[model samples]
Target chain A: MTDIRAKLRGFVLEELVYCEDPDTFSDDEDLLEAGLDSLGIMRLIMFAEREFGITLPDTEIEPDMVRNFNALTGWIESHRQ
Target chain B: MQLLEDFLANLSSHPRSCCLVEGGLRLSYREVAEKAGGVARQLLTLTLPEGYPVAVALPRGIDATCAVLGILASGRCYLPLDLKAPRLRQRWILEDSRAVAVIGHAPWNDLTLPWITIDTISPTPLEPLPLEMENLAAILYTSGSTGTPKGVALSHRAIHAFSDWAKELVSLGPEDRIAAIAPLHFDLSTFDLFSSLSSGASIHFLPEGLTIAPSHLTAWLSDTAITGFYSVPSLLSFWSWKGNLSASPLPDLRFLLFAGETFPTARLRQLAGYLPHTRLYNLYGPTETNVCCHWPVERETLDSDHPIPIGYPACGDRLYIAPRHNELWVQGPTLASGYWQQGQLHPFLNEEGWYQTGDRVGRNDQGEYVYRGRLDRMLKVSGHRVEPAEIEAALLSLPQVIECAVVGIEDWEGIRPAAAVVMQQDEAIPTIRALLKRTLPTYMLPSTIRRLDSLPRLSNGKPDLVSIQAILTR
Candidate 1:
């Protein structure tokens, strides 16, 4: 899970264009409040699907599941086959 | 002036109709009129001369709308300074307009003019002042390439004519609930604020801080029962790409109008697929002429993948093509008076009283005007002039290319055309480059074709040229 969190942060900076330092976030910080918009969420979801082979449920992906780094990683860990 | 007077009179009659909604707060037309009258009475207390420009620096919401109408009722024109712009930019606009006062509650103690706080105002009945038809209504500043923003001075006569035409063209009525998506400073806001106000329709503003949140935005659209949507193409693309459009279609939406920038054909097709019931329109114009031409998208044309024609001239405007270069020149009552700088008229107007649009266009086989590119965007490469849009169109024809922006970068070998491309999923960059080499002419091919995750966009969602240049140099 720690490795997944680090990889997710790397993708957030490079692909999502977060424009923030990687070390600025804690595990449970609100990513949406910290400048992670829906555009970033979409990109991150696609990245998770491609990299980890975890298919996020298209209709059931509530915004709360991606609210923070911990929630995102936990959701992916639960869903990955 | 009579049209405006009648519109205000009608609003005063309909007291219970919802006039605006912002930040989870809704106000009726009667309440808004009274609030505006209160501000107008306060402006009278300031004793500023008629026709003076007053700056409104509030956020895009109900208070800002009331402030503008109040200033207009006080027989003074209002300038909306975008609060989110750089402080230097806001100050430059305030200095250039030489405004008498700024009405807002934002904390930045840099103003030399008088300030009127939006919170301190109280509602009172005030009679509207009589004004001439040619009185200056608003001054919208466009970003200049040379770093100095040029103010486009529009008159009451111009907006009245344009809004009257728009109200009829879109068949707007009191039943329409128009979305106020654009900022107050953008020219698209004119339609959102005035046209809806004139027709007694409700203007629903997306709440502050939630505009870019697609889930919240989609939910709000359905919750508010919005009937008419107006925005730039970039916002529409973002909504269709990232928002839950397919999962929950907005059943109440009837029309989707976009302007202020070019809408890529692929994105438009995707949106049309998402909302098959909604009618889509592509409006074209600069800030000088507020939406001169428009195209109503047809189902057949969407499949052809041809660049959408800007369509016929609306708002009683006349379009003339330059014989040599086919540059579009617009002439009509809707044209802005001129660029304002220190009370002097700039050279935007020609000897024949037409605003040179600087857009190169030509009539296609169907007798519709097709946009080629901007005349100023023409670049010379290898002693041959190449239009970047031509190259972009060719690249977009390839199945792998989803979006592309072509710009000219200066090198030791003079100006060279470079493309920043966003490809479809899993498509390789080299495939697009090889496809472009086979399809385009040798001189028209981009010297450097770079793939990007996304194009850097401005606050208004148009592609940022300075950022594109930075990427090219890097």
Candidate 2:
């Protein structure tokens, strides 16, 4: 779980977000509010699929599924084969 | 005349016909008319000037639609404000337009303008005010090369001409269910709102944030049975790339119109393969002139790797190429009146009534207008018009550093604004970004910020944009 969270956070901070400080961004911080726009969200999904080798369903790409680092980890875990 | 006439005709001819669909809620033409009439009655009470600008700060939905219609009915210019934009930017637009009142659900106590809550008012029997064709209909704000945004004041005649042309071009009818995907602030929404409503077609308002989820967006289009759609190429490309467009073939989608940015030939070919039944069109124009040129994509043209032509003139617009520079100049009925700045109408058109579009064009052997590029430094980042100067101005406003240069960094995804700055003290990327967030919208915010020793200068002492772009790319 920590591995998944760390990977998700690393990718988001490196690519998806430019405003938030990675070291200070809490696990529960809202990614959307941190300037993760629609394009960023799309790129994040692609990155997660390639990194984890899991097919995240398009219908399941809701705000609740990827709102925060913890939520992103749980979503990836559920989709893991 | 087309807007008011068609709206009245639709109301009388098909009172019970479904006019708007958002989520599970469906509003008929009669219901929409009643709600809009209520809003109009409330505006009539104020007795503002004939063409006073009224801002609509509400989110995109049934209420926003009714508010716009009510503003038009009351013979006032409707100014749609982006609710998600930075508060300071919104305040700037409000001050520039000198809006007499705001029609919204929530009370904007900080804005000192008259706030008219549409829901609180009751529906009353009323008729639309007799407005002339030259009267202002809407004012759309776009990123200016200067620091502030410029408002393009569109007249009723312009809206009438464009909507009429769009209605005929798509052969829109009562049975067509159009998707209102673009926000009200975007120029594309004018077609979705005016063309759909005027033609008696039903419009489905896609919920906010649904655009972020490509798969869900595709599913929503299929579930809603949307027959017509208009949007920017960025969103369509994103949907085609990741939204599983091949798996979910939207049969109900008849015509797809894309504009605001160039659509890559390869991505467009893939999209064509995914949706073979739908017709694709490339619309071209700035907010100053609504859809001056358009090209219907033929399968044969997609075989080549070259960019598609913007094709023939649209909306009764005449295209002219300047001799010295290949800049495209447009003269048409759909031309906006002028720019609304400092509560004054400043005419942008030349003496001959031709608006010089900053875009460069070349005529093909077939005499079709081929888009070359923009003559100016303006960049279309994700279908949003962005001026590097605007971002640079915002960055310079912050006392953090010395000089800065902003440029568009183009990757496989699309072009995005990136900045290189020389700072007196070392500042974190997040700090600069946080300061910029107060003034710039999320799209205008630079995706990448790199601290530089100094920006490369040319022989004339101007910042060398090519070298800066290379640095950002590296």
For lDDT, the strongest prediction is 2
lDDT of 2 by residue, A6-74 (tens): 898888886667654689899888888877878888778878888889887766877777788888888
Best by DockQ: 2
What number of clashing residue pairs does each candidate have, in the order they appear? 0, 0
| Candidate 1 pairs with clashing backbones | none
Q: How high is the DockQ of candidate 2?
A: 0.51
Kindly report which residue pairs in candidate 2 clash with one another: none
* Model 1 misplaced stretches (Cα beyond 4 Å): A1-81, B49-51, B343-347, B377-474
Question: What RMSD, rounded to one decimal, does every model reach?
Answer: 10.9, 1.9
lDDT of candidate 1 over A1-81, digit per residue (tens)? 777878887776443433224465576877665545444565577778888887665444556777788888888888764
Please give the lDDT score for candidate 2. Answer: 0.87
Determine which window of 10 residues in candidate 2 chain B has minimal summed lDDT. Answer: B118-127
- Every prediction's TM-score for the first chain? 0.83, 0.91
TM-score of 2: 0.95
**Candidate 2 lDDT over residue span B167-261, tens digit each:** 89989999999999888889899899989988899999998787888888888889989998899988888788767787899999999999999
DockQ of candidate model 1: 0.18
Stretches of candidate 2 above 4 Å error? A1-7, A18-20, A49-60, A74-81
